[model samples]
Target: MTPKLKEDAQRLVIYIGESDRWRGKPLYAAILETLKAEGLAGATVIRGVAGFGAHSHIHTAAILRLSEDLPLIIHVIDTPEKIEHALELVRPMVREGLITLEDVRVVRYTHRYLNPLPADRLVEEVMTREVETLSPEMTVAAAWQKMLETLIKAMPVVDNSGQVLGMVTDEDLLERAGLQQRLSVAERLDKPLLDEEIARLRQSPLRVADVMSKPPITAQAREPLGLAAMRMAKHGIKRLPVLNDQGQLMGVLSRVDILRLLSEKPAMKMTAPLGATQTVRDVMTPVIPAVQQDDELPEIVEKLLESGTHRVIVLDGFGKAIGLISDSDVVARIQPSQRRGVIAALFGDALAPSSSVTAAELMSPGVLTARPETSLVQAARMMMNPKRKWLVVVDEQDKPLGLVDRHILLRALTAG
Candidate 1:
C-alpha cells in the first residue's frame, strides 16, 4: 500500500493577456513575484495557443507576428487562507483579467528536497526580508490591533534612524491592557459587560514606549543562526531584530525560522535516549487543578493567573477529565491548529454582539488522558508528540488525578 492523494487544497486561476501590464511591468511576472513574496510553495503559468475573451478579439499565436495579446493563465495552489492572501495581493495589480478560485485535492505530488543551509548560516542569510517594525510612539491599542490583523506575536520597535529601540510582544500588550485582572474565561458575563471591557482595553492611552522591552535583544547580521537561537531560548524571546553594522534594522528571525531550518535538514532528527520508567503514578503531578465545563470565563482566567501553571484541566460531574484550557487559548486572536476548535469559541462571548458564555464554550474539547498505572515510559512517549501539549492523569476509574506536562517528557528523556 503506497501513499496517495489524501489532502484538501485550493487552486487559483488567473486569466490575463500576455501584454497586460501592472505598474509598467508584465502581469505574469508581477503575479509570480507576488506569490513568491507571500511565501507560497509553488505556482505555474500556462500559455494558451489561441484564445479570445471579453472584447471578442482574435489573439492567436498561430503566426508569430500576430501573437500579440495571447491568452495566459496563472495557476497557484496553497492553503485557503494563503490563497485568499494571493488574491488580495493580485486584485489591485490585475486591472483587466478574469480571476477564479476552485477547490482541489492534492494527489501525488513530488519535489526534490533542498538541503538545509549549514547550522552556521549567518543571521542575515536566514532572516526574512520586508520585516515589519513598530514605532515607539504608536499607541498600545493600535499596536495590538495591528498584531491581531497580521497574526504576528511580536514586533521590533524602532527609532527614527531605523535603529532598533525595543521589542513588544502580545504578552506585553495584554498585561498593559489590564487583561490579567479578567483572565478567567469561566466567568459569567453579560454581552455588554464583555464588550465594554474589551473596548476599554483597546482604548488605553498608553504608547509602545511605555510597555515595550527597552534596549531590545537583537542579532547581528554577521552572527550565526545557532547563536541567535541560543540567545532566544536563554532569554525566552520569540524573535530577534536583525541589525547591520550600521546599527540599523536589517530583518527579523524567530523560533519559527529555526523550525523551518530543522525541517529542511533531514539528518537533524536525533533521538533522545532515556532510562526505564515505572508507572505514570510515579511521575504524574498528583495535585492538579480542576475546572468544570459550565464554569464562567472570568473564573477560569483567575484560576490560570493564580496557579501560574500553563493550563488547567476541565472535569465533568464524575471527576473525569473532559477538556482543558490554557492562557494562550484565551489570549491568542487566532487559534493555532494545535489547540481545539473550542479555543475560538472562547472568544465567542467577547465577539458576539450580545451574549453570555461559559467555560465549556472555551475549552479544548475531549482532553488527552493517561492512566496512573500506565508505564512512565509510555506516558512520556505519548507526550513526545509535538502537537499533544498537555494531558490529564487519571485514576483507575477514569477520575481526574493529575496532569502530564511537556516538561515531564523532558525529565523522562534524561532519566537514563
Candidate 2:
C-alpha cells in the first residue's frame, strides 16, 4: 500500500460476474464511465486469461465462449473520500461478486488539468536541444568509432541541408558484421572456389545508405509528451527528430529524456499539469558530451561512460551532432567470445582479452541532430515514438552538444 493513500481514501477492487447472457458490455462500460464521472484518479480493467470461481467448473477449451464465462477485474485508485462516494452507487447494484478495500501508497500523483494555459510556456522552455548526428558516407569502421567516442546506441543519418535521411543503429552494424563473419569461414573452407569468393567479399563496398533505415519520423518542438508517447508506442520506434517550423533539424528526443522528467520528485505531486507553463530549454541538460564524426566505437564508449553516464553525443569535426552512443550500443558490439571472457573474469580469471577493439569497429556513421531551443515536450514525443532513451543537443552548425533523458523532464514538471 502506498503511504500517501489518504486515510479517508482507499483503493478499491471490484469483481463482477462474467456471464455472456448478462449485460457484460454495459456493466464494464458503466464501471469505467462511473469511475471517471465520479472523478476517481484512474481505473484499470483486466481480462482473465483462465480462471473460475464459485461455479466450481473447469472453463477452458471453448471456441465461442460467451460473456458469462469470462472474468473481469476492476481496480480503482483514489482518495478514500472519492472511493466511498462512488461505492455508494456501486455497492447496491453489485450483489454477486466480491468488493474489497485496501490501503496503499502512491509513489507519485498528478493533478488532472482540464483546460491548461499555454501563454506562460514555450517549447524551448522544456525541450532538450542538445544532440548528436551521423553522415551517410561514413564506413562501418568510422561508424563504430563514433559509437565508442560518443557511447550512443543509435544515430540519425542526415544530409548537408540538415534534413534527416534515416537512422542507423549499433545493432544493425553488429548484425551485419556477424552475418558476414559466419559466412566467411563456410565460404573459405566449403567452397571449391574459396579464393574467388574471398576476393569478392573483400571487394564488396559497404556504405551507410546500404544499412540505414529511411523515412525517419519527426516531431515539432511544440507537441506534447503525451502525444509523443502515443506515437512512439504506435510506431514501435525508439527516437524522434525535432524539427523547426521550416522543417530544419533542431534536436533529437528519446524515452530516457521523458522518464528523467517524469520521475523527478518535484513532478510527482498533483499540482499544475505537465506543459502548463513549461518549455524545452527549462528541462534540457545543457552540458553535452560529444565525439567527432570520424571517431571509433571503443573510444566513444570510453568517453560516454567516462563520467559514469550511459550516453554521449556525436559530432562532426565542425562540432555539429552526428549521432549518439549508449551502454546498449556497447553491449550490442560484444562478441560471444568476448562475453565468455568477461564472464570468465567474473569467476576469478585475471587475464584480459588480448584483442584491442576500437570504436571505429562498432559505431554507425550517419547521425541525426537538433537545435538547442527545441521544446522538451516535442523532444519527449520524438523519443517515445522511436522508443529511444537518449537525445543529443546540438547547435546550428550540426555540432554535437549535450544529452537529455526523459526522467529530467518529469522532474522539472514536478518541481514546477
Candidate 3:
C-alpha cells in the first residue's frame, strides 16, 4: 500500500558523521537505503559544512583544516505510522547519532518529471466504471448477446458477490464450442444465419465458467495507470478488470483508455533534441502485410493469414498504399454464397480457394497514413476515430514503411 500524507505529518531528522561506517559502508548511505526499502514517502541527505557531536569535537570543511568526518543530516517526512515503522528499522543501523521527530505540515508534494510520460495519473481517473460482466451460471448464448450489445470483445465472469472468476473472450466461444464465427464476423452475417448461429449456441449446455480463462489478471483502482498498462502489455491483453481492496470489480481499463488520456494532454517535451525524441520509426513494426490492387481475394486472404493480422494494405503499381482490406470488408462486399467459406478460411478452418473477386472491388480506399517522423502522441490522436485502427507509416513517395496500432503505442507509453 502507498503511504499518504495528511494535514498532520511527522518529520524525522538523523544527524551522523560522513566518516561513520556500517558493515564496511557509509552509515548515511545505509540509512537512506533502509528507508527506501521500507517504502517511506521519500528521504533527503544533506552534508553540513561544520558541526560538533557528543564528543564536542568540531568537524569543518575549511581550506586550511579540512575534516574527514563532515556532519550529515537525513530528512524524512511522512505519516506518523510510516515514520514510526521506519524509525524501528533505522535506529539499529546508527551506532552513534542523534535522531529527532517532530510534527510538520505538508504544503504540497509532486513527482512531475519522474516519468517521460504522464504515468503519475491514477487508474480510477480513466477506468470504465460501468463494466459489463457475465455471471458464472449464464449460458454461452446469453453471454454472446451481452457482448454483442456492448460491442466488447471480452468480459469478466463473476459470481453473485461480483468477485471475478475468469474472463470470456470471443475466441473462447469459437474454440470451446462449435460457434461458426467471431463476434465481428457474426455481426456481419445475415439475419437468418445469425439466428441459426445463436440457436446452435443455445442448444449447448456450456456456461460462462466452462469457457472463461481461470485466474483472471486484474489491477487495483488506486494503482498508477502506468503500472496497469505494463501488466496489460506483458500479458498481451487488451483490457483488465479493475478491483478494489476487497477484490470486487469496480471498473475496466483498456489500452484505448490510456491512449485517450495521452491524446488529451499536451505533447511531452522530453529533454532530448527534437529529432532525437521518440517517433513512429522508433517503435513501429516494419515488413507489414501488403497486397497489390489487382490481387485476387484468395491472395489477400492468404496475406492476412500468413501475416497473422486481421487486415492487409493494398498497394498500387508504384508501390504506394491506395486502400486497405479487412475481414469485415470481405464479408460485407463479397457475394453471400461465398461468405461462409471465406470466414472459415480466415480463422484457419481451411484455405480459401482463388476467386475472380479482385482486391480493388473490396478494399476501403481511405487508408490512414503517417510519416516516420510523426510523434507518438500525434499518431495516437489520429487513431482516436473509431473507424481508424492502423496507421501506415509512409515515405515521401507515399510507400509503406511500418505500422502503428494501439498495441504498439501502448507498449511505447509503458516503456521506461
Per TM-score, the best of the predicted structures is: 3
Count of steric clashes across candidates, in order: 13, 127, 0
Kindly indicate the candidate among 1 and 2 with the higher lDDT: 1
TM-score of 3: 0.73
Tell me how many residue pairs clash in candidate 3. 0
Ranking 1 against 3 by lDDT, winner: 3
Which lDDT tens digits does candidate 3 get at residues 279-303? 7887899978999999998898899
Error of 3 at 196 (Å): 1.4
Give the candidate number with the greatest lDDT: 3
Residue 117 shift from truth in candidate 2, angstroms: 16
Whole-model lDDT per candidate: 0.67, 0.57, 0.84
> Which ten contiguous residues of candidate 3 have the minimum total lDDT?
108-117
Off by over 4 Å in 3: 1-116, 268-272
lDDT of 1 at 204: 78
Rate residue 61 of model 3 by lDDT. 89
